[model samples]
Target: MTTPGARAEAGTTRFTVRSPRAEAVWLCLFAGEAETRHAMERSGSDWTITLPGDLSGTLYGYRAAGPWAPEEGCWFDPAKLLVDPYAVELDRRFVQSPLLATFGEDTGGIVPRAVVPAPLAPLPPEQPRFARGGLVYELNVRGFTMLHPDVPEALRGTVAALAHPAVLAHLSRLNVTAVELMPIVAWVDERHLPPLGLVNSWGYNPVAMMALDPGLCPGGVAELRRTVEALHAAGIGVVLDLVFNHSGESDVHGGILSLRGLDDAMYARAPEPDGRLINDTGCGNTLDFANPAVRRLAIDTMRHFVTHCGVDGFRFDLAPILARGPGFDPAAPIFAEIGADPLLADRVLIAEPWDIGPGGYQLGAFPPNWLEWNDRFRDDVRRFWKGDGSIGVLATRLAGSTDIFGPQRVGEGCRSINFIAAHDGFTLADMVAYAERHNWANGENNRDGHGENFSWNNGVEGPSNDAAIIAARRRDLKALLGTLFASAGTIMLTAGDEFGRTQQGNNNAYCQDNAIGWVDWNARDLALEEHVIALSAARAGNLRTFAQFPDPVVWQSRDGKAMTVEDWERPGADWLRCSAPGTGFGFTIDRAERSVNIDS
Candidate 1:
């Protein structure tokens, strides 16, 4: 239980924190532009101290002095220096300041300090190189190596430019089992994006929760443990995506940083003169995983990224506000304390489930050993390739959604992570070229992203020097990367959507940190990245029948018999198929010949 910030040891260096209504909490430190503070000692909802020698790379933070009463949540600003929700490292980045929401406003030069972190050792507990139906990808470590031309303009956009060997040969030519990233922690920049000069380039507005974002991980947890040991020596796997449902100290007029000045009941409020904090992650607040000290700072920030940066699991962001004790509990005691944590039981978790609160659309309601971000398989595979859906909802999202993850977990192999385009919408070349949401450079005039993006435009909407509308947007992006590699499960793709990367139609470029959030890598589309590396070598040669829902099944139509429930509700039926033939696997699709034809 002794795990809250600082640590160090062998020459003294303890620190701790967890305020539980601070009436005092000091420990400030710093030394460069000199500071000091000390005075901790609470022990009962922690405060501790120890100090003497080994203050490893020292630069600490935290101040706390209780009750300023953020309407009842209590933000106690000892002139706000806070940051250290077990901050694994942060000595900069987290700018936005009205002196971090003013009040006594010293802000120690506007926040960001917590560095201490020098104890290394730990990475032995193996098993999590990520496999579960392979191919996850996602990305955004500074928009995937900020326009990487083999990443070395001083390691272009950080996380050590994803262990670059041209980013591990483009994630080993997309046979990537798990990259996911998207929020290399330490975020901030969302107080309406610095009054629209804009900035949160998608680190999803975090703030410490296990640091690592000295501007996209500047060699921190040993540069993410040497890029997870060089993506486990190129067999891929990192994961992350994090945002434990909100922090970046946002809501009640935001900012006293780090768990909102060390515990505004670590967010999640409402009820009682409308105490008001729970925004359920439209990112304004919400992070009281029913507070067992916010699930022990989310299981010690997932065991400091699996014992100091091995990291092979966690996607979470707005994941039904971690089974909301404020409402949505598919038996959430933080999912049995992360399935009784042994460094998070076999890791891989994933979720992004849903959360504008209330029933918060919990797709398949998490915990069947997690993994779910199937925005109903991205709006029924973009409304069945934008021809207005149904070939029975694209054969229930090409066989695995099983009506929102049921039918015995889609015949025993599905938690459904399928994707039609992510990192929050539109690219797969702007969902076949932007039917809407251009975002007016996100000043919020085109009212920010996703306005029903079961998108379309194929005839010519955004960029087109018109070679037949860029060959019908690369033939609807090779029929949406051949219906996300003939569906089934754990799919995902996002990072430059296999070589097309266009935020030009800005599906909320998350405050476009320049070049509309990087990744141009010389205008990619090497024939749609060799058709997503031949659909990741045909889903790695049918990885266990694309990880489930393939077995003696048939489902045909277009005259090869079988299919009828009136050919999955006829209306211009388009065409269908689906074969399994005891795992030779299948596909076919057509949608009036925009084609997809996979067949293992």
Candidate 2:
């Protein structure tokens, strides 16, 4: 099962690849434009070759001989050398060339080559600390500290910036258990971005899933290890947001990147009649994880991160795709394997819970030990605070949405992750000030981004000069923060949301990696930051209020009387109160819950 790519032995190195469709496979070595090809022996689904003498630091690739029929999904081009699917390191950036899509041409100098590094050391002993009912602060690698003054000028926008004393101190102050970093894996710009003169800073469109982006991790895995070590020393954990649903390679017309060039069968292609790609993700190609080889690739990639880079967990983007056979299933092989894997059993797993594909909104259907982003909680809380409904639904969300998460309450804390804003949508500030999306700068003539953002403009659409409107907006922001903290589930806060960071109402700033995306640290609203700090500390002090069981909630009406079923169904009844024991705090709409004294 471990046989994949170059692995150094006592005095020799072995190269293995799984190409079920290829008739023959060759191990090609490159040295100063001179090439040497060695034919590989076939063993079922694996093709392998072993070479003697210490063969570390060698640059190599592979070529498979087979059919070249794209219409039926067998794309085997012996001339267009392929990258090892398990390549740990790439020598340079993958330069896009039109010749890569065609067959039978010696692409000697242009294709990316895999590097065999010296033997790696074992990872640190696993001691994951992320679990239920803790805070997770999500931040972007480059944009997080790009403008921080304390970070070194050279390392301002790299992974190294995260370990800087200033950044670590700030994280420590927030009391979050983990930092959920956005995609750090190697990715490429979309084909359309070049004509519009834009860059892909989000790194979601990944080509090499295992390789870390050079711009972020220049020293490769060593840099990542150092950052992880630093965070562990500071009592913080790292959670990587991974995107394995699709690759940077688009459809047939798009460029042939890593996986597609190696084998077209790796993707989830449509059934007969059309034979087109199953674009479940908004991205062009969805990986066929039902294939054993692709499943192995994904498992091996996660193992490498855990055994080499010391990552604590993974937050899968568009997670439903990984469980697709004919349709999404909770018992998908990948899920079963991860649940049973020794290395991953204790690691925290989170899911974005939906995609553009059919039957993709499988929110509470994930297996146990996995957490999900609660969009229902987000929307309900937003609508309630924005004056669309009563506080009844919001009360349910603050109690961990037992009706949605499950009445059983199998886990100790909560399975839902509560948040008012995230990366794809508007910031906390923009959410309160924008009635509609302002994505005119995304080059789509303002037609892009979500239509219903659940946002309110307070009175004016954009920036306001009225004192009453400003005060109300600030109050609403604090109320939202309090509700998030007072909730029973894990709370999430974007990097710069505490001090009112805004993208000028650009709900979708995925492509605008300029001032529109980076956190403006210089314009910190100190008052708002301090207020959030107090809210966080208060939340921590009152954790006992949310007991482990789902039955901790005891609902009451505005008059402090127990509510009946008729009261709950009453359309006119708005104000509600929910109380729990030990934490001495109460969840109420118009009034604050009295903190009970233990002395009594």
Which candidate leads in TM-score? 2
What TM-score does model 1 achieve against the real structure?
0.36
Cα lDDT of model 1 by residue, 1-600, tens digit: 667788888899998888878888998897887898989988888889897789899898888887786777777879888887887888888898878877887888878898887878888998998766778888888777877877778888888888989889878987888888887878888787777777888877777777888877777888888988898898888888788887776777777777777777777788898888778778787887787888878878888889988888988887888878899989989888889888898899888778887899888888787888888778877887888877788788877877777763444478888888887867888777878878888887887677888788877788888788888878888887888888877798888778888988888788888997788889887987987898888888777677787655888887899987877887879888878665677878787779897864
- The deviation in Å at residue 160 for candidate 1 is 3.8
Q: Which ten residues in a row have the lowest lDDT in candidate 1?
A: 403-412
- Quote each prediction's TM-score: 0.36, 0.93
Question: How many clashes (backbone atoms < 3 Å, residues ≥3 apart in a chain or on different chains) does model 1 have?
Answer: 0
